[model samples]
Target: MSDHSNNNNSWHLSIVERKFLLLWCDFIIVFGAIFLAVILRSTISMDLFLQRGYFGIIFLYTSLTVAIFYIIDLYNIFLIDFWTSIVPRIFIGVALTSLLVIVSSFFLEFLALPRKSIVFMSVVIILGMMLTRYYLMIVKRYPLNIMVLGSGFAALKMIEDIKKSGSAYFHIIGIYDDDDRKHGKEVMEIPIRGGIESFAADIKELRPQMVVVSFEKEIKETWTDILLQCARSNVQVSSAVDIYCKLFGKVPSDHIDALWLLSGIQLIRKPYFIFKRFCDIIFSLIGLFIMLLIFPFVFVIMKITSPGPIFFSQVRVGLNGSHFRIHKFRTMVVDAEKRTGAVWATKGDNRITAFGKFMRKVRIDELPQCWNILKGDMSIVGPRPERPEFVDMLKERITFYDERHLVKPGLTGWAQVLYPYGNTIEDATEKLHYDLFYIRNMSVFMDMKIILKTIATVIGGRGGM
Candidate 1:
C-alpha cells in the first residue's frame, strides 16, 4: 500500500481548510473592527475598556458576529459571485448580529456599548468582510488542477458534482485509466489522457496540484507506483470518496461499499452522546414551552379550518430500528390517509389545509417533536425520523439504509436541511448520502452547524414539501 498519509498536506487546500482560513480571517476582522470603533468614537480607551471588563463583552460580540455570518452562509466559499450572494448575506448577518447585541445589552449592563460605537463597529465589520471576501474570490478564482487517475463511473460522477458545485475550486485537467479502449475518449468532456504507464510523463506536462485515484476496484501495482511517485513529487493524491465528501458535503452512497462503511464510520464518543443528550433535553424543554404558548391558537385554527385533532401522531423508526410515536401539529385533514394509506407528502397536496400549509412552510408542524426529543425517543439534531412503513420499504431497496438508525432520529437533521423534502425512493437515496455523512462525522460542532442551517431553512421556507 502507498503511504497516503505522507502527502496529506499538499499545495492544494481542501474545502475544510479554506473554510477554516475564512473563519480566522473573519475573527481577525471582528477584532480589528472593535479596535477601530473604539478609536473612532473616542468614548472609551483600550486600557479603560479592558479594566472595566469590556474585553470579555467585546469577545462575546465578536464571536456572535462571526457565528451569525456563518449561519447566514457568508462563509460559503463555494458561492460563485461575491456581489450576488455574499454581499447581501453579509448585510443580513451584520444586521442580525447588531440586533442581538442590542437586545443582549439591555439585559446585561456590562455588555452595553455606546450607540455610536456600535454603529461604527457594524459599518467597519461589514466593509472589512466584503474586502476580505473579494480578496478570497480573486485568490481562489483559479481552480485547483486535478488530474484524475480513472475514467470509470466514480470519476465521471465526481466530475459532474464538481461542475454542479458552481465554484471555481476544482478543474479536472485530464484522466488516466488502465483500460486500453478508454484511452483518447472523453468522460464528461474530460479527456482520458492514457493508461497508468503514461502517468509520469503526464504529471510533468500537466503539473496538476492533486491526483485523484478513482479506480472502482483494488489498485494495481502500476497505479500504486504512480501514487507513490506523486507522493514523492509533493502532489496530493486522494481517493474519490475523500474528494467527493469534502467538496459536496455528502458521501457517495452509490460508490461506497461495506468495507468503506465499516472503516470510515466513527464511533460516537460518550462525551458527545452526553452533550447531545443534554442539549436535546434543554432545547426540547424550551421548544415545548414555546409550543405550549402557541398551542391554543393552533388548536382553534385547526378546529375551524380542518375539523380534526390538533396533534398528529404516527409510528416512526427511531434509534436501533425501534418504533416510537412522532408527534406533530396536524397539518392535514382527519382521515386524509384513509383512502390512500401511507404515502409521502407531496408539494401543494390537496390534503393540506390553508393553515396547515402555512404551518408546514414555517416548520411549525415540527414543534411537537420536541416532546419526543425530550422523552429521549429522538434528538434535537440527527437524521430525521422516517415513518416505519417507509423505512421498511426503503431498507429493502437502499444499501446501508439501516445504518441511519444507529443514531437517534431528530426534529431537524443534516439531510432535512441540505436536501429537500424527500418523497420518492431516489430522493431517499440522495438523502441517505447526507445522513451517512452525518453519521460518519458526528460531532457537537456538526450538530450545531445543522441546527443553524435548520434555522435558516425555516426562515427561508425553501426546503419544505
Candidate 2:
C-alpha cells in the first residue's frame, strides 16, 4: 500500500479543529499570564494562590477574554492577517476584557487584581497571543493540494471563491473532466489534467490529499466506483457542496440541487426544538422588560422628532409559510412606505427621521420584536423573516428560498448578524445562502453564538436599515 493509504484522516488540520486548538491555546496563555502576574506581584506560593480564589478568578478572566476575542472575530484564523487584523483586534479585545473584569470585580471582591498586575498581565497576554498566531500562520503556509474532478462552472466558481477567501489552506492542483475538448484547456490557470477515464491512474500520480467531486450531472457508476476506491484507499473524497459549505459557512444556492436540499436538511432532535422554545420564551420576556423600561424615553423622542406612530406592524412570512404581524419601533415617517408600496429600504432614505437613524444604529427599533417572539411568531435566533411580497418574489427567483420558513423567523439571526441589510434581489439571494445554512445547522449553541455576534454588532453600531 502507498503512504497515502496509511491513515484515514487527512494530514492537514480541519478548520473547526484549528479553531478549537486556538481556543484551547488562548485559554492556557491567559491562565499562564495571570499566574505570572500574581507571582511577580507577590511572594505567595502556589498553595497561597489556590487559597485566594485563584481558580475562580482565572476562570472568570479566561472565559471573558475568550468571549471578547470571539465576538471580535479573532478565532477566524483563516481570515486574519497577523499585523493588520490580529494585532489591532487583540488590543480591542484585551481592553474590553479588562474593563469588564474591573466592573465585575466591584461586585465580587476576590476577582480584583492589583493595577500593576493587570498592566503586566495585559502585556504578557498581547505578546503571547501574537506569538501563538504567528506560529499558526507559519505552520499553515503550505496549502493542502486538492484535485477537483470536474471542469464545470461550479468547479470554476468554487476555485474562484477559494481564492477570494484569501486562505492559504487549500490549493487547487488540477481539474479533471470527461469532456475531450476541455481536457487540454485551462480554467482559471489550472490545467484540465485529463478525462474521468484516467481518474484512478491520475490519483496515483498526483496523490492529492483531497479530491473534490463537482460534477453537476448524475455521476456514472464507474466514476462512483473510482471515488469509492479512493475512499477505501484512505484518500479524502468530498462533494463540492460539502467543501463550499465548510469554506464559506453558507450553502451555494446556485450549485445545489433539490435532492441535495432534501437530504441535507438536518434532522434536529425534538428535544432541541423544545429547549430552543423554552429559551426563546425566557429571553423574549427579558427583552420585553428592557423594552418597557426604554419605551417611555423612546416614545418621547419619537413624538418630538417625527409625527409617526410609535410602533410599526407589517405582515411577514413566518414559520411554514404562515403570515404574521411583525412589530418594530417606527423608525420612519408614518406614511413612509405609502408611495413605494412595500419596497426595500434604501441607504439614507429621506423617509427616515433623523432620530430614526440613531435608533436603527443602536437597534432600538428591533426591541419591539420581543412581542412577536412572545407571541410565538418568531424565535430568539433563526432566519430573519421577510415581507410576504418579498418572500413571494424571492421564492420564485432564489433556489431553496422558502426553506428558511421551515423554522420561525427571528429578531436576530445568523444571516442578520453575518450579512448586512439587504435592499436588492441580489442581496436577498446572497443572504438566503446564510439562512439555509442556519436552518440546516440550528442548535442552542449556534443560537448563542449568533446572539453574541448580534450584541457585538449592536455595540459597534453597525446595524443597517
Candidate 3:
C-alpha cells in the first residue's frame, strides 16, 4: 500500500480509541474460542448431539475461564514488543485450563463430559486464540508509522534498535536532519529526506504518520511549528524517550533525568494504590486456592525427603521500607547462609538441597507468596522484594534504588523475568533499568505482560538465579 502521507483530511482513531477497539477484538476472540470448542466436541459421528442444558453448562464454564483470562490481562492490546512474547503464555493458559477442567470434574455436579473432549477443546482453543491474535495484529495496523527528524549517528542507532524489536510494526519512511554534509546520502537504506529548517514544512507537506523528534538536546522551541502542524493534521508526535520505550521495550537509562523521575505523574496516586491492593487480594485468593489443592502432594514429598519446614519465612523490606515476613517453600538448606552471609545464589550452589534446586528452577517456591499478596505487603506483579541487608547496601550503591519502594513489592517482576536474579551491584543496576521501565509504564496490561514473561522464564529455566 502507498503511504497515506498526504491524507490530511482523513480521520484516524486516537490512541485511546484504538486501545478500546483492540479490547473489543480480544473479547470476540475469547467467545469465538468457546464456540469453536463446542463445535469440535459435538461434530463427530461417534457422539450424539448435546442435550438442552449442554449449552448452558458450556456457557458457564466458558464464562469463568474467560473471566480468568481477562483478569490475567490477556485482552490488552499489548505494545509491539509485548505482543511478540505471547506464544508461551498461550501454552501455559491452555495447560491451566485443562488442569482446571480435570479438577472441576471431581467436585462440580455437572454431567460427565468425556476427557478426550476436554483435551481436544483445550488444544483447539489454544491454537485458535493464538491465531486470532496474529490475525488481529494484521487488521489493527499497529506499530504506527514513525518518522525520525534526524540523520546523524543517533538516528542510525535508533534504526538499529528497531531492527532488534520483534513486537513493533514500525515502518520508518525516511530521515530528516540539519546536516547538509550528509544530505543526499542513504544511512542504512533509509534516505535522508531533508534538513531541520524545512522539517516542519516537509512534515506538513508529507503528513507522515508520526514525527519522532530525535535531536540530542531539548528542542521544544524548534518543535513548536511541527508539533502544531502535526496536531492539527492528525499525526502523532513523540519525544526520543517515548519512541525508545515504544521501540526497545525498555527505557533508556541515559535519558532519564532527576526532574522527570520526580514529576507529578511519576508519584503514586491513592486510587492506583488501592486498586493495586484490591487486585492483589482477589488474585491471591484464587492463587491460594490452587496452592492449597497442590499442598498435600508438595507437602508430602518435602516431608518424606527433607528435614526442614515446608514453608520458609524471611524478613524482606516491603512498601516504604516496612518489614514483612515473606513466605516461600524452602528452596535451600537450613544453614545455607551460616558461612557466607547474604551471598547470591549461583547455579549448582552447594547450599541448595536437591528438592530445593528443583523448586527454585521451576519457581514453585514462590507459590506461597500469594499469602503475602493477600497481606497487602506485596503485589502479584511489581519490583521483587529485597532483603533488608541487601537493601541497605544497594540503597547506598544504586541511584534511585529507594524509589522502587514507592510501590509494594511483587511475586514475579519485570526484572525477575527479563533479567537474571541480582548477584552483584552491576546486575542490580541492570534490573533497576527494567524496574524503572515497569514503574513508568505500570498498568494492568503491563502487569499481565510481566506475568506472561514469568511463565516463560519458569518453563525455560531462563535467567534463573
Candidate 4:
C-alpha cells in the first residue's frame, strides 16, 4: 500500500495534502484580493485615504472570509474545476464577509465601513481570483503523464477524455498492448511503445506519473510486472475507471463495481448533510417566493402559448434509491412521451411546445423544483434527479449506477452544470462521471460552486435535461 502519510513530492497529492493546499490557496487569494481591493477602492478609485477604523474593519472582514471559506472547504483545490469553481465560493465568501461589514458599521461610530467599497471589493476579488486561476492553469499546468497498457476502444476513449480535459498535466504518453499488429502501430495518435515485456523498462525510463492497466488477461504477466514496477517506483497508478473519474469527474457506468463502492471513499458527510438541508430550506423558500411573485405573468405567457397545467410532475429517484415526484414548469405537450416510451429530448425536440422550447433552453422549466427542495425530496445541489423508470433500467445496464443514490438528488448538480444535457445511454455514462465526482467530493463549497456555475449555465442558455 502506498503510505499516504509519507511526505512525498509526487504530483499526485494525498487527501490530507489536498485539504491543506485547498485552505492555503483560498487564504492567499481571498486576503490578497481584499487588501488589494481596499487600497484601490479607498485611495485610487475614491481619491481619499480610508480612516484607520474603516481600514481595520476591512481587514477584519477579509479575515472572516478566510474562516467562511474554511468552513465551506473552498480551499480544496484538487476537487475544484478552477474556472467553474472559484467565483461562486468567492461570492459566498464575499457575501458573508460583507454582512460583517454592515453589522460592524452599525456598532462602530467613527469607522463607517463604506458599503459601496465592500460590494466593489467582492466583485473585484471574484473576477481577479478567477482570472488568476486560469492564468495559473496556463503557466503551471502539469499534464498527468499516463502510459496505458492497452490498445483498444477503452484505451481510445481514455486518451480522448484526457485531451478534452484542457488540463496541462493530463497526457497519454503511450500505449502498451501485446497485439502483434498494434505493437508498432499508433492507436488514436498515441504511439504503441511495445508489447507487455517492454512495459516495465519503458515505465522506469519514462517515469510516467500514472500507469493505466486496462489490458485483458492474455498479457497478464507483462502488464502485472509493469504495474508492480511502477508501483515500486512511486509512480501514480490508475485504471480506465480511475482516469475516467479524474479527467471526466465521475466513475463510468461500464466500470463501476461493488469494490469501488466499498473502497472506503465516502464523499457525503454530516456537515454536507446539515448544510445541504439548510440550503434546501433557505434557498427553496426564496425561490418559491420569487416564483410566486413572477407566476402571474409567467402563467399568462404559458397559457397563451400552450394549453396545459403550469406544473409538470414526474416520479424521480431520490436519496437511497427512493422515489418522489419531482416538480417542474411544463415544458412539453401532454403525453409527449406516450409513443416514444421515455425517450430523450433532443436539441430541437418536436414534443416541446413553443414556450417549452424557450423554457428548456433557459432552464426556466426547472424553476418549480424549488418546491421539491422545500418538500425534502430534493436538494439545491447534488446528482440531478433521474426518473424512476430510467434509474431502474440504468441500474440493470450500468455498473455503480446505484452509487449516486447514496445522497439526496438535486435540482441542479455537478453533472448538470459541467456536462450538457444527457440524451442517450452514452451521454448518461459520460454525465455519471461528473455525478460521481460530486458525490465523492460533496461539500458546502462544492455545492456553492455548482450553484454559481448553474447561474452561468442558465445565462448562457446552453444547459438542461
Candidate 5:
C-alpha cells in the first residue's frame, strides 16, 4: 500500500535500524509501566512514593528491566512474522525481568512497596509489548523492492533468506546476472533480469530501493563501476554477505575472502581485549567458587561411576598457534582415546559413563576450564578451543581454520551456543560459519548474548556429547 519506489533516501531497513526502533519502543513501554505501577499503587502516590526517597527506585527498576530484556535477547524481535517470534521473547523478557526484580528486592527494601503493583506492571509491560509489535506489523508498513545482481549460489542463498524473513518488509522484484545461460531462469519465483551492465539504467527503470551485489566469482571491473555509479546516486547497494548475515545470523563461509576479513574484523580494539581478559578472570573466579561448592559431590560421582580420575586434562590448541592443557571434570572413560586416538565423541559414544553424560548435558564437565580462563589460555567468550590433533586435521580440510586462533580460545563460545555439539567435519564446517560471524562481530554485546544462550542450553540439557 505504501510506495517508496522513487525515494532517493531509500526504503532499506538495516539491522541497526531495527534494533534502535525496538529499543525506543522498549524504553517507552518501561517508563509507561513504571508510571502505571505508581498510579495503581494509590490514587495519587507522589507523596507516598517520594516519602521514602525511593524516586531513584523507579529509575533503577526501569533500567534493570530494560537491561535484562537486552541480556535475554528480547530485542532480536523481527517485524516480519512478528507473532511467531516476538511472543516468546516478550514472555521470557518479562518473566526474567520480574525474577530480577524479586531477587533485588531482598537487598533493597522499599517501604510500602506494593508487590501486587509490581506484578501488575510486568503484565502490563508484556501486553504493551504485544500491542507495540502488532501495531508495527499491521500498520504504517512499507516494503522495499530490492534486486540482486548475480546468479550465483550466494545470491540464491540471499534470495531464500529474504523470502523467508522479508515478507511484507522486503519485496524482491528481480535478479540480474551476466550469465546468458541464466538469462531466463527464475530464483525463488522471481525472474532473472539478465545482465547488470547498465545497473544505473536498471535503477532508473525498476526503482528498486536496494541493489545487492552477489557475484560468486570475481567481480568484473565494468560491473563494479556501474554499482559505484548507482551508489553515487544514493541507491542502497549492499553485498550478498551483508544481507545473508542480517537474515541467517552467520556469514557466508563459502563466499568469504581476505577482503571481508580485513573490513569486518579490524574493529577489535586493544581496550576490548584488555577488558575482555579482565572479565574472564573475574567471572572465572566466581564460577570456580561455585564449582568448588559442588565439586565434592561431582568428583565422587564421577570417580564412583567412571572409575577415572576426578579431573580430565587434554592438549588443546590456543591463541597464536600455541597449545595449552585444558581441564574439565571427567566426562569420559580415562582412556577414551587409547584405542582410537584423537577421535571426537559421538552422540552415543560408549566411552561416556552415566555420570559423564549427565555432566556433559548440564555442562558441569566444562566447569574446570575456568582454571584455563584464569591462566589466560582462554577467554570467557571466543571460539571454542579444539584439540591440536583435530585442529591440524580441520586446518587441512577447512578454509581459514587457523584464523580462529587470532584470539584466545573460550570455555564456552559463540559456535557452541548457536550450533549443537559437532562430532563430524561437516558439523565443524557449519560451526565455523558461526565462529567467523562471532569473530567479525566480536564485542561486549555479542559476548553477553553467547553467555545467555549457553546458560539456556545448559538449563535445557541440550547439545551433550
Candidate 6:
C-alpha cells in the first residue's frame, strides 16, 4: 500500500485505495492527452480514438508510459515530498516510452504514425500530466478527514505513518486520549487536544469523517458508548490496525499479536498458486533464453577474470521450510567463504572480482536462477530464498521470520526489488516486513508489478546483493 493502492479511490478507503485512484487518474490523463492529440491532428471525433484501429496503439502507448512511471518510483506515496523529485524521472520515462514506440515502429507495420503526431502527442501528454499533477497537488479535495482516538503506542505509530505519508487526500485532525498528562500535549506537533473528558465535544466540533481507535488497552466503557453514539451520528468508526494495514502494505510489527498471525492462514490460495506456477514456467523459459544468449560472453569473461567455476550453487531455504540448491553465475572469488565459512556479503567486499561486480550490478549473476524456477524450486515472484545459516539466525532473532517460507521462494521478489541489500539481522528484519506484505497481498497484478519493477531495478543497476 505504500507503493500502490487498490482500484477503489474513495476517501474513506485506506491510503492504498485513494492512491489507486490517483494512479488511474494519471493513466487517464496521459492517455487522454494522446487521444486529444490524435483528434486534433487527424481531425477525428473523440469516440474515434477508441475505434479498433486507433485503440490498439493508444493502449500500448498509455500502458507502457504508466509502467515506466511506476518503474521510476512515481507512485511511491510514502515519499515526503515527491513533486520536487519526480520531474527528471518523469522526463526519462516519457523519453523511454517514446523511444520504445519509435523502435517498435520498424517491426510493426501498423505503427507508422506521422512523426509530427508522435511528437505532438508526447508534448500533450507531458503537459497534460504536469498540469493535472500540479492541479491535484494544489487541490484540498480529500474524501477522508480522520480523527485518531488514542494516546498509546499504537496511536503514536499510526500518527507517525500518516505524518510520513504526505498524503494529499488524507487529513488527520488530531489525537484524542483520556490521559491527563497528554490532554494538552502535542504528538508529532499535532495537538493531543483534550482526553476522554472532551472527546465527544471535540468530535462534534472537528466533524471528522472517520475515527480510528488505537488504544493499547480498552478505553472506558463510557467512551465506547460515546464512540458508538458518534458513529450513529454519521461518523465512521474504524480500527487502527485496519487503517495501519491500509496505509502500509504490511501489518505493523509491534501489533502482530496472536489473532493477526492466525488471520494470515487464509492467505494460502491454491488457485492463485497454480496460476503463479504457470507464470514461473513461462517467464523462466524467457529468462533461460536470455541467459543462453549471453552464456558465451559471460563464460569467456569468467574464464579471463577469476579462477573459479562459471556457476555456483548454494543450499537455500524454500517452501514449507524445504531446502534446495540455488544456482547462480559465480560472483565471488573461488572458495571465497573458505576462511569465514558462511558470512554475509559486505559492501564493496574485496572477495568480489571485477566481473563479479558487473554481473551482480546488472543481475546477470541471477540468470541461472531461472533453472530453479523451471525446476519448481522457486517462483517468479515471492520472497527471496535465504541460506539455512541466515534463516536459522533470522528465525531466532526476528519475529515471524519462518512465515516467509510458507510461500515459494523467488528469483526476484517484493523484498528483493523494494529493499536494499541486507547484510545484517536488522536489515533482514526490514526485508521480512516487505516479504510479509507480499505474502498477504499476493495476486496476479501484484506479481506482474514486482516483475516489471525488478526489470527496472536491474536496469538501474541497483538492488539487494
Best by TM-score: 1
Q: Residue 274 of candidate 3: its Cα lDDT?
A: 75
Give the deviation of candidate 6 from the true structure as CA RMSD.
6.8
- What lDDT is reached at residue 88 by model 5? 64
How do the candidates rank by TM-score, highest first? Answer: 1, 5, 2, 6, 4, 3
Positional deviation of 157 in candidate 2, in angstroms? 2.0
Give candidate 1 regions above 4 Å deviation.
Answer: 1-35, 42-115, 118-126, 138-140
Candidates in order have lDDT scores of 0.79, 0.78, 0.69, 0.69, 0.76, 0.75
Q: What does the lDDT come to for candidate 5?
A: 0.76
Local error of candidate 4 at residue 181 (angstroms) = 9.0
Prediction-by-prediction clash tally: 0, 0, 1, 9, 0, 2
Report the C-alpha lDDT of model 2 over 1-465, residue by residue, as the tens digit.
Answer: 112332233335544556788899889888887667656766667787788877777787788789878877788744534676578778877787668767876885544668987888888888888888776674634445678998656667778888776665566767888778878777776778787766777777656667888886778787898888877766678888777776677888788776777665657788998998899899999999999999999989989989758999889999999999989998889888777888888887998889889999999899889889988999989888888988898889987898888889998888888788869888998899998888777776678768877888989989866
Q: Give a tens-digit lDDT track for model 1, residues 1-465.
A: 011221232235545566788898888888777756655656667688778777677787788888877876677654655675578778777788778767887786644668887888789878988887776565535455778987656677888877775665466777888889988887767778788667778687656678888886778987788789888777788888877776676888878887777665556678989988999999999999999999999988788888868889999999999999999998888899999999898877999888988998898899999999999999998888888889989999998999899889988888888787768899999999999888887887678778877887778876466
Candidate 2 regions with alpha-carbon error over 4 angstroms: 1-133, 138-140, 196-198
What TM-score should be assigned to candidate 1? 0.80
Report the C-alpha lDDT of model 6 over 1-465, residue by residue, as the tens digit: 111131134344344554576678778877876666556656555565466477777777788888878876677544334354445556666777678767876875444457887787678667766665555544534335678888667667877877677665566677787778877777787677777767788676556667888887877898899889877777778778766665665566656664575576576678988888888899899999999999999999899988669999999999999999999999888999999999999998998888888888888899899999999999988888999998998899988898888789988787787678968888888888788778777787678768877887878878545
Model 3, runs deviating above 4 Å: 1-78, 81-144, 150-158, 166-168, 178-194, 204-206, 262-269, 282-306, 309-311, 392-398, 420-426, 448-465
Q: Which residue runs does candidate 5 get wrong by more than 4 Å?
A: 1-31, 42-113, 135-144, 161-170, 196-209, 216-235
Q: Clashing residue pairs, candidate 2?
A: none
- List ranges where model 6 is wrong by over 4 Å: 1-130, 138-144, 161-171, 219-236, 261-269
Report the lDDT of model 4 for residue 175: 83
